[model samples]
Target: MKFLKNKITGITIVLIVILVALSPWIIWHFKPDRHLDVLVFDKTVPQNNYREHKGFIWLLNSFKYTKLNGDKYGLLDYFGFFPEPNYKYKIKPLPKDLSKYDLLYVTDTYGVYDRDFYGTSKNIEGERSQKIYGGTQSSEISSIKSALENSNKSKTLIVEFNSLASPTDTKVQKEMDQLLGLKWSGWIGREFKTLNKNNEEIPRWVFRNYRKQYGKEWNFTGSGYVFVKNDDTLMILEKRKDTTKDMTFKFSPKGQEDFGIKREVGYYYWFDIMEKVNNTESIADYTFFLTESGKDKFKKFGIPTSFPAITESKIKNHITYYFSGDYADKGEFPVVYQAVGLPKINSLLISDYGNTDSFFWKIYAPVMQKILDNTYEKKSSETKTASIN
Candidate 1:
């Protein structure tokens, strides 16, 4: 009887140990971490109203391969503030005890809360707020500024959606200038109100007209120029009106040299002429423009345009070109775009966070990988110095 009792006790102890060891994985199976603490401040819960919610969920699930284990990861919804461990609560003032978190993310809806209270311990601030069109309440630029200033512990990455409201009204421009001055790495999200979805022939005609006036091909090469810096590459597509006002020469006849002909030039007229010449709808086209520096960088890499074409070399390098719309549709795992407003924001989050040879591991892994690597490197350097001494 004594022997049987001891055997039962041992089995129970073994089972408990196994359960403890597997607890983290078990909990993670239900709610996995994307190596990020997404604090959604939007008034909508589960972001059901926004189309991007599906894409967001998809993005979250794509990280399952990483299978990172930890309690440090979760989502906080800041609509009606309450601390619910099961459902990441949205608290008004960020908790002072954020030492445990490595990254913090803020989305739309929460722009009204006091950001200064969050105390900036985050490494990334993904801002997708744009000016409220019609009658919507736009995200506050001051809040973005406060969040950036407070997050002094590490570099803060801002993902601004479209044009920030005029700098005169808000301090967003000032904060942006400061960030640029600090040499922080960042990118801007430019959204186009209209897209060219007509047949290829129409696009070709538009291209031809653009080339005749600009002395460049209107295809990928011309379009690519907008993202290129120098080389007189005007890749950006301006509205026909804007382009005519900026690029065309007005004709006037006051002297014999000018002939007896005078013509008033309007921007759209040039586009109309092009369309007539090409037998197409309208010649006026719009395109997103990158900063001069960004364009120059693209030129150096031979990546001239934003069109989605993956070359063999790029594929070898594991570089993938993602179109804004395509990314919104397919990038997220479970499709969160339906819940979040994917159409409203034109942005992409590119990081080697999930890549096998990720930038994060390249930059931070050596610090802890085999303490001997650090020890040996330190000893070897010290020895060389000693020899010199």
Candidate 2:
């Protein structure tokens, strides 16, 4: 009788221990839908290199909730955290219910993978040496296109094709062109000077005109050959003007604005630029911030006075935003990391884990936060999404 009683107590204690161990997962599984369901289509990131890709991975990690172990990730932690975005990282096939997720992030490396992005993958190759993948997989681009098409909430789709090298797959390029309301004109190599903020002449590409965040302004000047042509559905809400005062702020480039916000970003000296096209509008543009000699050289190439640097458009109820460059490059990430307050999480990955801010908070984590803040608004529940079959 004593032996049997002891055995029953031991089993009960073991069962209680197991239940306690699994409680967090159980609570999450049956929990009410309070958090945003964010889906990251992350196949665009290449595995094998750890250092270069660390910044990108750090960005993704910022969206995640860390687990108790702190050093390793369990199954529950792998899916993501609660309260804000319960991010489910999907790489291969698109999820079945297209409308289920609140936000979709496609890295859109096109075909060329960044050597820096290769950095993190190299560090992760201890288990399987042969399984390391570098470039985007086949059919993945088509799958993303299909997802966008099938999703009525396509506006929630956040994508940036970071590569200047056009997709060798013409089909991918064509689909992106039609979808973005601009035709990809390939790459360019040049230098960009700081926008003349105090000159009283508002440069066509000055994007820092937004009211301000935390009572401050920020802008980037990078040379990437990203050219685009507008389609029939284009909307140039505000055409390129020499200078104009819109929204109370006057056009005073040199003497008018804070000096800290206006700086040059000249990586990928030769990059891609775009022209406005169908069903789209240009909100930001490239400035002629060149020296007389540089201007003469650019003119010889027959480049236009200015081109749209930022643009937006709607397709099938989804609103997609496009930019000329990415914030993941080596030159830009450090500054962004400092601005975002994670100064140590760059070039090298930091293992210290904790809960990160929401998407709205972290979205500004990159250089484009200002642009997004002024342009894209959070979608209300009442906002209508297209019905996809």
Candidate 3:
């Protein structure tokens, strides 16, 4: 009897040990909140109403993205503020403690809160109180500055949907300018079209190609864009800011540096262009923001500067990837004209996201991932080493 009793006691002890060994893995695999925290700024795009922008969704649905018991265990399981734990109540201000997260994403353009805050003002009672209003307060910008400043311990990435509105609140714009070393000017319109192959849009850049079946083909050749930088990646759609070198170019059917390949039928329509921030002089030290064309057109509009859509910035352990243009809003905008909202299509301005994919994203996302995946500092022993090489 004593031997049998001892055997039972031994089995119980072994069972408890097994449970203890397996508990963490089980909890993390089945419940992500058990071990992850994240701070995300998901202010609405004000235009992507259908939720067609799948950039965030793609990361979430990825296979083994949140797997535990392996290297993938520490992936972005607790995304910005939404995965409310089983019984935790949602609140306005972020939790006082954010040392637990591995990544912080401030991914939006205009700080739209309760429509009334910006855009078409509306009265959505309950929703307005909850949002971080555009220009909520200088304190909010201070918070973001503090987070990025203090993020020496984690990988921090902030993507401004509309780079112009890094911090939409006017109150915070000054703080943001200091934090990013860049300032919002105004939207620069690009003149490009979606690559509509047959009935399907491939969701990628189709180079400088369009159809002129509806209007005079020669007038719509999109003649102004000249090769400033030989970067084939960003050189696709033309209509770069007017440049002195652009006065003379061999006219071609294909509309490239070389002439006479084939007549590429296209259109000359205005687009919502994003320009480099105001601190063009300081930007060269960090990331060389895009280049301005023949002249600073925005100066006439009060922006005082203009540049193409390309940018990169790094601050201490916190690195920011800026997409000067809003890729989500496909390069499509019917306007009176880019200068002063002249008018296009009609006297009214029409806005829409073209197809399944945005041409800007095709080139921007991969490059951005390459830049953000690595840590970079200013004038360091590693600065000479390329981030992607």
- Per-candidate TM equals 0.29, 0.46, 0.43
Q: Best candidate, lDDT-wise?
A: 2
- Comparing 2 with 3 on lDDT, the higher-scoring candidate is 2
Candidate 1 CA-lDDT value:
0.28
Q: All models: lDDT?
A: 0.28, 0.39, 0.36
lDDT of 2 by residue, 1-389 (tens): 99999999999999999997766556544543223344444333332222222344444333232222333222122111111123222234445455555455554353213331333323222122222222333454455456667764433555554432333345655566666787666543232223323322232222222223123453323211222222211111121232121111111243114121332222222235667687777644455444455455445545654665546676566666565444333212332221223432231242211111211122224433332232233443434332231
Query: Which portions of model 3 miss their true places by more than 4 Å?
Result: 1-38, 45-53, 60-64, 67-96, 109-137, 163-167, 187-299, 302-310, 328-361, 375-389
For model 1, what is the error of residue 108's alpha carbon versus the real structure, in angstroms, after optimal superposition?
A: 8.7
Q: Looking at model 1, which ten-residue stretch has the lowest summed lDDT? A: 268-277
Best by TM-score: 2
CA RMSD for every model?
A: 21.1, 17.1, 18.1
User: How many residue pairs in model 2 have overlapping backbones?
Assistant: 54
